[model samples]
Target: YCEKFCVFVVSMDRSFLPETPVPSSLSRRIGGGHWDKPYNRGSLMLRAEISTVGDSQEVSSIHSGQSRLTTVGDRLMDSKCKCGAKEQLILCKSRLEHLVGDDRKRRRCAVNRGKLAAAGQAALRILSDDLLAAVTEAEAEMKACAARIIQEELVAGQLRESEIGIVERGCALGALRDKVASLRAIEKASQEKLRRHVDRREAERGSVLEQLHSRLAVCNELRATLTAIKSRLSLMRHRVRSRQDSLEVARSDMEVYRKVLDEVPAIMVDLANGERETLQRREELERRAMALSEEMKEIDTQIASVTNSRAQEVGGRKRCLEREGKELDQLAQRLDAMQEYVGDCQQRRMSGSSRL
Candidate 1:
């Protein structure tokens, strides 16, 4: 820590002012020299106005004729100077206290010397009392300075904690923002998928409706064709009934023919037997006729021989024999007529059987 001490002077006119100027060399000599050394008025007032600022390693801000102090305190040093100005001291801690104390002691000694030259032992007693009072005041000021430093340190620590909390809150806010963005993206994708599903369902519904319409048309056409087939079936049933009636009439005629066919075999057997008998009878008659013709020829030869030998001798006998020959011719003619009649009967029998 660094400390600052300032000392100011009040003139007899009761206003802050610079003290009577002193040479830099004389001020330095007075500050470093022993108290027993003789001093001048400018040096005494200059020492009373002197102040210092001190750090750990170096000290500065000591002016010979001016001060860096912007404010003057009501606290005065227990000393008076030949220039008729009073001294005001504002003390700090550590080395600043020492510097101010030494300057005060010197000012007091100079004041004491002048008063001692006039008032003797009584003036020395008053100076001693003022020095003790100044020391007590210095100690109280040091305690106040220590308390102020501690308060400043506490304020600085609170500020650092607040800054750290702010940084952590900022990081948490950033993470929350990123999580919200991802959720929004997922919601958008879900909505898009739902839209696509709706479109596909619409397409399928349209195709199903078209198929239903086509199937309905085909059903109507089949209904019309079924009506036409039913009408044709009714007409075919009528034609079949008429044809069935014709078939019944033909069945009756076939039964009668079947009975006649059963009798025809026996009738054919009888006709074959009759034709065999006729053929045998006709063959017998032809053999008999052939014999008769041969006999007639022989008789003709005999009659011819007789007529040639007895032609004049038997004329009447020839007349009788010619009459017998004419009668034989008549019998042969009658046999020819009977043979034709038998042939005609045979022809009539064959025609009758053929007709059957």
Candidate 2:
């Protein structure tokens, strides 16, 4: 009757026990749990609502432990007794193999699960013996003593688990504190690096901008120089055209002079009217033709000088164009490199922020 009443009371307690939130995968992975470590033992008791349908919440004691008080009570109401710790361990190993499908993971779970199964079996044994005592009254005194001894052991186990839990958590907390400190240091370093990069980028941009301005100025000067060269070339072309027209006029004059010379001989023979006046007119025409020929020679020399100057100006402009193209290409390459660098910095900033 006492055992049954105790079982009833434990069920009632479990019914009202609060549930704890599960941890996330990332935290669990980083937690670095050891199978023998206390925190990994799970909660003091697995209180399922299904097992204690009518039970409700009440206060629990710190010293007695849920394991000592409730192990038998909880298990008596269970559908079937799970096998002993060793068998459960085998079962856990099989589960690890079947579910994990990896040697390392299975090994990790096996280590943890093996300890868990042992604790569970120890718990189950207490419950099984309790039920056995309830059904059979033989050796009641011995069983009672055994029950008290088991309860004490269970309570001590629970206390050890609790203490280990606190210690492990303290260790974990310390680790986390150290990590936070380290992260802060890294963050400071990165921020400083980023600031330096920003300063460097600013200086580079300013220099590049100044260079661009200078290039623009040079380009403007070059344009003005080219315009001046064009004007000079146009003037030269006009002079050459005018000289060509003068040369044509001189040739026509020479042809007229030759015809006049031919007629002079003819006139002398015929003894025509006013022969002295005709000879005077012919000499004046010869002098005019000679003057035209000298003018033609001067025009040809001026044309040659103008053409040479034009060729020199064109060559100079070609050289300038080639130099300007090379400068522009260098600037373009620098611009591309700067753009790529800026992009990489932005990407790093994004990745760092996401990690935080």
Candidate 3:
């Protein structure tokens, strides 16, 4: 009977004891229990009764225990553990363990994901910075290339303008050179013509001088002949006067004889014949003087013609000389113009070369 009573006590103690603590590794399996039970066993409840005596010590102990239990129940409610059976507890400690493990794993995963996202963002930021730097460098290079091209183009344009100017100046110089050449040719021809004219004029002047000298000699000879003729004329006149005086004396003698010879007629006729012969000789001398005067007039006309011809020749030579001088002046001016043009061309060429 005692053993049986002890067994009953042990059984009751076992029912009141807390459930065994589940291992952390095995908590998930226990929380997910699939054990089968009958419908009536799930609904069954076991009850225990205790006897109380009035004024008993055990009763006081029991009342004190009951009060303590009630106080513990109130405290459990406040702590949010209102369920009475530890084995059938609403707040599953085994499930809580499993949930803590699950939460730790989730938190670790979230942390890893956040770290990965941060690393990716950092990598993207670095790539973007590098790209921006490369783009800026390329833009700067492009700008530099454009600036260099513009400078080259401006220089080329200036060179082209200089070349064009040089070409135009060259053309002008060429034209001037041609003009100078033509003028030189003209001047040369004019000089040759002038020389020929001078030569001819000099020859003509020499011929005129010779003719004048010859005419002068002829005039001197004529003058000498005229002087001799005048001397002979004077001598003839004196001889005629002496003969007249003799004739007068003879006539006076003859008159005395005629008175004596009034009886002789032959002597008187001979004296009359002699007087007629003397008169005829005087008339012939006057005729010779008139013929000499006509000859002198003809000589004067020939001298006047020679003088007029010499004057005309001299005037023609003077006009020719003036024309030649003018041609020489024109040639000099043309040469000067050509020289200036050449100088201009040289300056332009030098300027163009420097620019190039």
Best by TM-score: 3
- Looking at candidate 1, the ten consecutive residues that score lowest on lDDT are 1-10
lDDT computed for candidate 2: 0.49
In the range 15-130, model 1's lDDT, one tens digit per residue, is: 34334443443333111122222344435435433422222112233332234342231112223433222312323323344645665786686456434333433433444464
TM-score of 2: 0.24
lDDT tens digits, residue span 107-209, model 2: 5654565554455445445555654554364345447546755765675676577558656755765676576567567656755765675577567556655
User: Local error of candidate 3 at 87, Å?
Assistant: 42
Q: What C-alpha lDDT do the candidate models reach, one value each?
A: 0.45, 0.49, 0.48
Superposition-based RMSD of candidate 2 using all C-alpha atoms, in angstroms: 44.8
At residue 58, give the lDDT of candidate 1.
Answer: 27
Please state every model's RMSD to the true fold in angstroms.
79.0, 44.8, 39.4
Alpha-carbon TM-score of each model against the true structure: 0.26, 0.24, 0.30
Candidate 1 TM-score over all chains jointly = 0.26
Error of 1 at 296 (Å): 99
**Candidate 3 clashing pairs?**
none
Q: What are the clash counts of all predictions, listed in order? A: 0, 0, 0
